[model samples]
Target: MDSASVYTRCQDRLLDLAAELTAEQLATPVPALPDWTVLQTYAHLAGVCADVVGGLVPPSDDTTTARQVAERAGDDLDAVCAEWRSQAPALLEVFARETRARYRLPALDVWHHENDIRGALGLGAQTLDADQLAHFTVGGLARGWAPDVPGVRVVAVDTGQEWLLGERADLELRAEAFELARAVTGRRSVRQIAAMDWKGDPSAVAHRLPTLPAPEVDLAV
Candidate 1:
């Protein structure tokens, strides 16, 4: 699918899930993302959409702070979802009018956040399609964030996907895209990575990945 189509479909899926949640459920802690509840996750997702869209078009020299974005979204989960829904069309329109090279934010964030919400809500039974998975894997590796660790082949066993960063394929680790993404982003443990086989030191590679803050459970009480 094209960028606009993907954004629209992602928005639809998010809204559909949002509509099914109760206030209590929305505030409840997410098992997958222990740091954020459903409500907080919704808020963050909406805030990200607003921030990115606003960054692209911008709002007349009005620079919004992170706190402001969170505050504006408030604790009303549905309202936040509605705002995201409203923004999606405009964002899609803007994206359609522009070229892919000009697209703001990394492509991984788009799919990562989508998977994040789905995993948190237990709605992602089906994995990403072959094309999407390949895109994410290759794009992630090419992004060059992985450290110069020797013998580490970042492999997604489910998809038979592998990206050899260094000279040797000494470490063979297996995980789903989300898990792999999280590991690459330093949010999850390499130990949590299933079917992991390694010859060299995994810690060196782990250090190269971005250190994601531990998932927090703060929500509207």
Candidate 2:
């Protein structure tokens, strides 16, 4: 499947899973994501989706200030999620018609947030497939935090999956793409991955990982 297909499938799956949850279940605290409940997870995913869609429709000539963007997104969680779900069809339609290069948001943002929701619910074992994994690896490198960080190589210790980033001379790390993505995104700490025997310069590499914004709570319901 193409990148657009991959994105749509991932988004649909998340929506399906979210539809399965009860309000109470949505509010249940995710042990893995201590700061966020399932409801917050849904809101975050939906909010980010909306943000990406907004960015795509008319490509921004200049990046909007963070506060201004946040203001445009509003402080209401349910409103954001509702707006996102309502707007997704148009966004997906546009995405299907455009090339990856034309996409407004980085593909990694979609994949990572999908994983975030799944991970919080302990659904990783069920949701992510091999193809999605490959897409995520590429997306992570493409949307990596620092443009200046030398490209690093990743070797998944268990599965032996290998992918290259930046320059060959950069440090090589051995860990599953999922774990590496999580660590890079700050969902998981360096020490946490180290316990799993991931090898890398944690201090130097960790700082280059993309930072997710703070999650918003669902107060409307």
Q: Model 1: per-residue lDDT, tens digit, 67-173?
A: 43456544586678778778776676567665654363323344555566656655643244434534444455546644445556666666666776656676655
TM-score of each: 0.69, 0.59
What are the root-mean-square deviations of the candidates from the true structure over C-alphas?
Answer: 5.4, 6.6
**List of clashing residue pairs for candidate 1:** 35-215, 35-216
Candidate 2 lDDT over residue span 128-197, tens digit each: 4434454454456645545567666667665666766665536666766566555544555444533444
Clashes of 1: 2
Specify the highest-TM-score model's number: 1
Model 1, residue 218: distance off in Å is: 17
Q: lDDT (CA) for every model shown?
A: 0.54, 0.54
Task: Report the error of model 1 at residue 187, Å.
Answer: 4.5
